[model samples]
Target: MTIPNLENNRVKLSLLDLSNYTHLESIAQQKDLIYYSPSDISTPEALKAYVQTAVDGYYHKNTIPFIVFDKISKNYAGSTRYGLISWKDKVLHIGWTWIGYEFQGIGLNTNMKFLMLQYAFETLEFEKVEFRIDDRNQKSRKAVEKLGATLEGVLRSDKLMKDGYRRNTCCYGILKAEWPEVKEKLLAVIG
Candidate 1:
């Protein structure tokens, strides 16, 4: 149940090679992806701290994050990851994902997610993949739904964000048994 740090496939829209801090810092500075309404990353220092946290997490193998690159735009669009892996349960969570505003609704996420799901199911042999989105994030909720994940439920007071209050989280997931059909549907929608 060892998940590789990097999973490459033809469908990958971008690869976030975070082994280099400068690259990660540069990608984080791109405002489009980092400029969401509720986003608290206003300065380079703040972004660096955030990237450092992610880097630390990845280096320790607790989290794996990647940068999203749009082949057409030839620019880094955002970041996504495999977090909170439960090897014994054959489960993994893919959340804390963000795509720049320009890349939204452009199939970039679909392609990236397709690659991730393939790697998780085929390579890591995970039984289930989950996404936990902020309850207030309709865009994310819709995107996950479009990816063919089922909304499981909501965890009230799930966590505290930079804004200093507990945020409710909406859970969505697709099991191994559902991936075939789900993947097909996703391809059709994105293609």
Candidate 2:
């Protein structure tokens, strides 16, 4: 996919790579920032490995990872990605997203999601974008709901968490046909 300046006044998104991996170090050490995640990035070494995994995904041609920058706070917030991308199906899934505790509730996520959703639907011309959140992650689920993704279903014991507990994954989706309305809602809130 072609990429240019991916900022929306409030946030910026750049391809996550080794050169930009240091940008995420500042916020990635926050404990339990992504408690629901199967991987641990709470330490510097682990965070580097986490970034390497994203880079690998990009090379594998299944995902596009991004390092998020919060312009309002002038901070490199965290990371998010479009994974499990299927060009044949015209669909993509957005997951592996997390921001620092300080960045939460600052309208950063909304602005970032607005840009991502726009890119997936309008620019890439994907038919559907999906989000999978752990069932116990109510905060994340609600955030995606705010972006107009509907709960499609739940997959029990879907993923093994870092804490050694299995999590039920909640699948959410927003179709291309629904983007116009979702875009309006996000614009209203972000504005």
Candidate that would win on lDDT: 2
Query: Tens-digit lDDT track for model 2 on 128-156?
Result: 99999999999999999989999999999
Please report the TM-score between candidate 2 and the true structure.
0.96
| Global lDDT scores for all candidate models | 0.71, 0.90
Least accurate stretch of 10 residues (summed lDDT) in model 1? 7-16
Q: TM-score each candidate.
A: 0.82, 0.96
Model 1 residue runs over 4 Å out of place are: 1-40
lDDT of the structure predicted as candidate 2: 0.90
Superposed by TM-score, candidate 1 places the C-alpha of residue 171 at a distance from the truth, in angstroms, of: 1.0
Q: Per-residue lDDT tens digits of candidate 1, residues 1-191?
A: 24444423323333344354344455455554532223444466765565666667766666676766566766666678788878789898997677656677777777778888878898888999999888887888898898889999999988777657678889899999999998788767656
